[model samples]
Every structure is written in C-alpha cells, then in structure tokens.
Target: MKLFDFNKYFPDEKACRKAFKEMRDREGVVCQHCGSHDVVWLESKQQYQCKHCRHRTTLRSGTVMHGSKLPFMYWFIAMHLLTATKKSISAAELQRQLGHKRYQRLVTKQEHP
Candidate 1:
C-alpha cells in the first residue's frame, strides 16, 4: 500500500496493535508452550494467555518487531516503503525517510534477516 493508504488504515500505535490482534485472532493463536489452541485474549496486558499452560504470548511475540524498541508504526511504514518501491530501498534511505537519528537497529534487523 501507499503511504497515504497505510496511514489511513493504521494511523497510530493503537490502530496497529488492534489490527495485529485481530489478524492473530482470526488465524488462531496457538500456545507456543503447550501446542494448544485454547488461548484467551488478555486485553489489559495486550497478550494472549494460553488456557492450558497459562503462558502469555505478547502481541509482538514471534513477530519481526518482537525485540525491537521501535514502534509498530515504524515497522509498518518501513514495510510499506520496502514493498511499494519499484527499485531497491537501501537501509540508509529508509532511515532517512523515517527521520530517525538512531536507526541502526532497524536497518540491521532488515539486513540480517
């Protein structure tokens, strides 16, 4: 999607989180700890609690941004830019477009994996 379309769909962190939660729920959240599909949404904690094992799976768990400090919006925007461009988008260009002073981690993440 274009930047405008992406912004329209996911305007903020909350929107992105909600979308992510809905997508995960639609796909069904399996308990990584016990291999069970009996999971409950813990809205307060923004995680999935495995009914069988009681293990909490975070919204970002098993996602590309799991351990990243950057916001979901950043990742979403980065994804859009990376895919929308006809030519390759370099990490430096992406960092510049993101207007982040310290974007080494974001760039490195995109590069390594």
Candidate 2:
C-alpha cells in the first residue's frame, strides 16, 4: 500500500474537488436533511442537495473545514506540516506558518484572553 501525499498532489481546489467527488461517490453521499442518496449538485457553491427534502450541504459541511474562511490548500498544507514534525507543533506556530490571522486569534482566545 502507498501513502497518499497532499502537498505533492492535492494543492488546489480542482484537485481537492476531484478527490472529494471520487471519495464521496465511493462512500456515497447521504442527504444531511433526509439521509437519502438522491442528491444534486448546487454547482455555484460546490454543495450537494437532498432531492427528498431539498436540503443543501457544502463540501466542507460536517468536515474539519466547516465554517472556516481558509482556503482548501491551507488545510492540506497544515496537515502535511503537522505529520512531518515529531515533537508536535503549537497552534501559534501553525497559525504563523499558515498566516491565518483568524485561527491565530481563535487559538489565542481559546488559550488565554
């Protein structure tokens, strides 16, 4: 078995989209509203819909990226960096590396004030 690399391959929306589509298809997408396989793509927003209940869900919905303003590549890079290190990197370090001020503030508020 070969380990998949995100930085070496998926570094953009197109790659992420292709991988997500394949994975979603393989695992099958369940409607967030009705838990049905009958779904449609919303296109402009990169979301899926439940034909039975008309519920729309995003690619990042229920995912780690849910409610994030960061780009898809940011998550990929962060994961790759985290796995490459041994001693464990702090959120401050990760935030500085990724240059995400939002997360920086988020972690800061969570830890201190």
Give the TM-scores of the predictions, in the order they appear: 0.84, 0.67
Over 28-86, each residue of candidate 1 has an lDDT whose tens digit, in order, gives 88888998999999878888999988998887776677666678888878888999999
Lowest-sum lDDT 10-residue window in model 2: 104-113
Query: How far in Å is the alpha carbon of 94 misplaced in model 2?
Result: 0.6
Question: Which regions of candidate 2 deviate over 4 angstroms?
Answer: 1-6, 20-28, 40-45, 102-113
What lDDT would each prediction earn against the true structure? 0.82, 0.69
lDDT of 2 by residue, 6-39 (tens): 5457857678666766667677778867789898
| Clash pairs detected, candidate 2 | none
